[model samples]
Target: MNREAGMILISTMLMLALLALLVVSQMQTVFLVYKSLNRLVDKHQSFYQLEMIAQKLSSFNNNQLQAACLVTEKNPDEVFTLLKNGKACSLSYEQQSFFYLIEELGFFPCMQTVKEKGIYSTQHWRLTVLAKDERFNFLQLRIARIAPFIRCEKKPLVFIHTGIISWRYLVR
Candidate 1:
């Protein structure tokens, strides 16, 4: 081949290699971003699931369930023991495989608010919830302080009193 033609071929080969490298680098970056986004989505969904589980547990009104939770407060191991015997009263909402503990912290009068004139007593309960998903190797631990009003107001009061007072997380 002529000298000029050989020079052109060599320069073109170098440019093609550089272009391929850039494309590979870009693809790697995109793949990493996709993986991180998937992880973020998993964390977000797990958090929401934990919150929903907490809400369902806090709204429990069953006497036997409450008594069982009290048992757990004194000794958490009792929960596993009861669960093994299929006699636990702790609420499990779905087949998601989750467990929660309820501990009665204290009770006090409700906060004085401009909207509501009559303020009665409120029960302070601490709820610790743990959820596990073996498929994704995911586990989340969340703790919340929930206060459900002890007294009902006239006209069926409509509000959410038990939610998101405190939260902690453990992701694996």
Candidate 2:
């Protein structure tokens, strides 16, 4: 072969190699982005499930409260049975399957008494819910309830009270 032809062939091969490297690098970046997006979607779904559980608890009426309270306190094991037995309550609406791995759960009571107008005697109780999944870390839910105490006389009056309490979260 001629000298000029040989040099052209060498240059063309080098250019092809560089082009292949660039393409591979671009593909790797795209793959990493796709993986990150998938992880984010999974995390969002898990968080949605957790929030739904909280909302369900919030919507509980007196009857539901009494039932759940009794089950949890008296027969803790039965709480799962009530949740899973699927005999009386509607579990379809709450996405029960996603929460099947709940690791911890509980409910607590709180009270406040008003001795005078615009005053309150405050007390606190805690209800805790905990769950863990392989896809995510520990998830915990805590609900706080407040009730006012009053004395009955010829006439009864209600008092207003305000306070802020904080709870802590632990992950394992």
Give per-residue CA lDDT, model 1, range 103-130, as digits (tens): 6656443431122554444445555556
Q: Whole-model lDDT for model 1 versus the true structure? A: 0.55
Among the numbered candidates, top TM-score falls to: 1
Report clashes for each candidate as comma-separated counts: 0, 1
Candidate 1 residue 5 C-alpha distance from true site, Å: 1.9
Maximum-lDDT candidate: 1
Report the CA-based lDDT of candidate 2 relative to the real structure.
0.44
Score each candidate by Cα lDDT. 0.55, 0.44
TM-score of each: 0.62, 0.54
lDDT of 2 by residue, 82-144 (tens): 333432223233433322222122321223344534333343323233334553232333333
Clashing pairs in 2: 104-130
Model 2 worst lDDT run, 10 consecutive residues: 100-109
Q: After superposing candidate 1 on the true structure, give the runs of residues whose Cα lies further than 4 Å from its correct spot.
A: 66-68, 71-95, 109-119, 134-172
